[model samples]
Target: MGGNKVAIVTGGARGIGRGCALALAEKGLDIAIVDMLEPEMARTVGEITALGRVARWYVADVADHARAAVVVGQVAADFGRIDVLVNNAGRGNPKGILEITEEEFDRTIAVNLKSCFNFIQPVVPVMRAGGGGRIVSMSSLNAHSGGVTSAVSKFSYAAAKAGIIGLTRALAKELGPEIAINCVCPGVIETELGNSLTKARGPELMKGIALGRLGTPRDVAGLVAFLATVEPNFITGQDFIIDGFQWVV
Candidate 1:
């Protein structure tokens, strides 16, 4: 299993995942996109291909454990090696504790938190077999701030993102020397999923941010690409906050 570097980016159909995938491809890594959005995924694959890199899309839910294993196997078989795994697939939960159902809470955890475990377990072995690799998971500033009052993601989403931090720390120890793992916590980023919140709070939110503006998918993608491609990496288990210093949240 040997070729150019390869990366698997979950939720790579659009938004932040798309940015990460394109950034990695620009860094000369083949991209394997995992997402449920067919048209968007196809568009992203074409974009990566246009960058002169191999690009493939896998249709699967990130929260499915068995499916994650299957997809990882297929990626290894198709790409011949796994160099990076970006766990970026997640959904926001706007419901409060009082209104959310038990199933809804569980699904939020499964999709946002447990899904990391599902992919990491299978990808870790493949990465180890490939000699060594890097893992950058997408957490959120909500993990630290508990989100603002007008935020679209609330308690359940924050909890899941926080779990990603814990998982990154623990796995850094468990998979160390063979694999380097880290997570990133981005503040209010302007993406399709996040536009509603941004449109409503853009001006108000910018006032609190040191940068005096909201963030973009490329803003987060740059950090992820750095963590993935940084040579002789000495960093792991750390959560890099790319929030432009938003003091309000």
Candidate 2:
């Protein structure tokens, strides 16, 4: 469906980002991954290549504005064009209001929120030049629920994720008709980062989910693939929740 197109997925080394990368690859798009995990990122590139698609990996801290620009430019040059961008790179903060230091809070916002702007600004011109493109950022269910008492992330993470929704909404309007912008809010996806939480609350958590199972990377990936490749798409400026109908978190 996305034949000959190229997608850049941040944090595409593992977990949901990797899932999204593979799913997009399955739809016939080449992938360019940006992440700091060298070995895991290389492994993901190999997997995408095995699917008969061109894939490359770049190591960068997504929070660095200049570095993101350089990486985006490199990807555009290497791939010839940029078609899809998935802002799926982020970190979780388990600290509460008091325990968290100032540096940690700032870093959380930079990594989770500012990184979106960093990537989007550069990619927009590339997408516009090439006709148009689709952008999906990974928000969290935490944004909506404000995180459960036992949740892995606390107020700071929620704030950053919530900021992503606003970013998506504003950018959708500003970049629209040509570039489609959207974000996804996922609940408790069973990724490496979230495994500890899942293991600790496995049974108790499932009861609250309508699907009676923890979400998988594949679960979120499918929705991302659809958003990235859907034809005659009128969908944009929206946040789709892929949480298996969780009434409680």
Candidate 3:
């Protein structure tokens, strides 16, 4: 909330993650951006620094628990405390059940679900030590409504995202008033990854959205930033869907 408070956003190099990083930075929180993309990560750091907030970048795969621990520890050492953790790094595999291999399924679960645990586990103690914290995980509308794309329509991605909701609830209970954990499930956002998937699926996918247009990363980021900063600390363990009413229709 203050300029001195520190936040970490995983996969903050680009897309939805980048939007969240910028949103938080604009709010005056120093940021630690973790991503596998070195150049892009550095660019995000530069942007945050230009915002007059301290910014640091850590390059590592979110799925690697050991590396995540080290990176988070380094962040704690650098920032003195971590006030918010946004688990925004994830991968979507759009293959039908018959077409999806076990390895691919595992990778999807690892990135989308396990990575949340990897980042949260280390940061929980840091947050508790700092008195309290906020955690926002990136989820997908496909987790509730089935995916329209032929690739992910099989169910693995949805299942993995659903798992994220479960984890958010369980962790929220475990952390109690000390930390708040929540998930944001976005629908058909027009990020580079989203556009690629939409192109892969064709125009019919766009027509299905009640809004008649795809969502954007900023649309989702706005909600994420709100949940992270606004606090009487009552909202926890909830999953907010930003689908432009697509699910309603």
Candidate 4:
């Protein structure tokens, strides 16, 4: 609120999304949380306010382009400008291709991939008008490996995550010298959902990580904060892997 820079964090209610919002707020940026979880969104807003940043939440599914456009426009107007966009909104698709229903597959693509396109379309115009901006979207280690075992999705999730990387690369080429766009494929973070996924495989997971530990949301958030706030932005079209060298690809 007090700062001039403003950032919009999708899925900013919890998990890595909340981490990214708080990190940006810590760096003195106003926050606009685009998420459907109203209660969690309020909690995240409180944290941002505690850090002395202006914060607001818009309840809507990010995959809906029309609704997403309205919120993005409102944020630009309310903050007077949009400095960064973090497309961290996504859901884990647990079923493999053959096991997943058609509806489930569609939902996964809508939330994990199409949502990026939805918000980016509206925000780009605002960023271009403002002269520059930063975009950091969340992909996953699944993008590289397709997934570890029969537990995680082998096709849908991996495809969606890979799409984010491809989308980021193309956007960087189009928005370069102005807006910097990048994606990160994080592996086994300690968020509630992440912990649940790894509960049975903690020891096995740790063995895969060269650092002997899984990543934290803060680790991923720190990179996003840097991409948004750092100057002379030469870094774009990159897919950063924050998995402690587990799925190094």
Best by lDDT: 1
In what order do the candidates fall by lDDT, top score first? 1, 2, 4, 3
| Residues 1-249, model 3: lDDT tens digits | 122889999999999999999999998889999999999999989988999889999988999999999999999998899999999998778687888899999988988899999999999999988889999999888788767444443488788889999999998889888899999999777877787767775476766777778888889889999999995668999999897777431
In angstroms, give how far residue 46 of model 3 lies from its true place.
Answer: 1.2
lDDT tens readout by residue for model 2, 99-148: 99999999999999999999999999999888999999999999999985
lDDT of 4 by residue, 66-124 (tens): 99999998998788899899999988777865689999988888999999999999998
The pairs that clash in candidate 2 are none
What residue runs in model 3 are displaced by over 4 Å at the alpha carbon? 1-3, 148-154, 200-202, 247-249
TM-score of each: 0.98, 0.98, 0.94, 0.95
Q: Which tens-of-lDDT digit does each residue in 1-249 have in candidate 1?
A: 788999999999999999999999999999999999999999999999999999999999999999999999999999999999999999999899899999999999999999999999999989999999999999999999998474578999999999999999999999998899999999988898678787777778889999888889999999999999998789999999998899875
For candidate 1, what is the lDDT? 0.94
As for TM-score, the candidate ahead, 3 or 4, is 4
Q: Candidate 3 deviates by what RMSD?
A: 2.2
Question: Please, what is the whole-model Cα lDDT of each candidate in the order they appear?
Answer: 0.94, 0.94, 0.87, 0.87
Could you give me the TM-score of model 3 versus the true structure? Answer: 0.94
Candidates 2 and 4 compared: the better one by TM-score is 2
Question: Candidate 4 — worst ten consecutive residues by lDDT sum?
Answer: 146-155
How far residue 146's Cα lies from its native spot in candidate 3, in Å, is 2.6
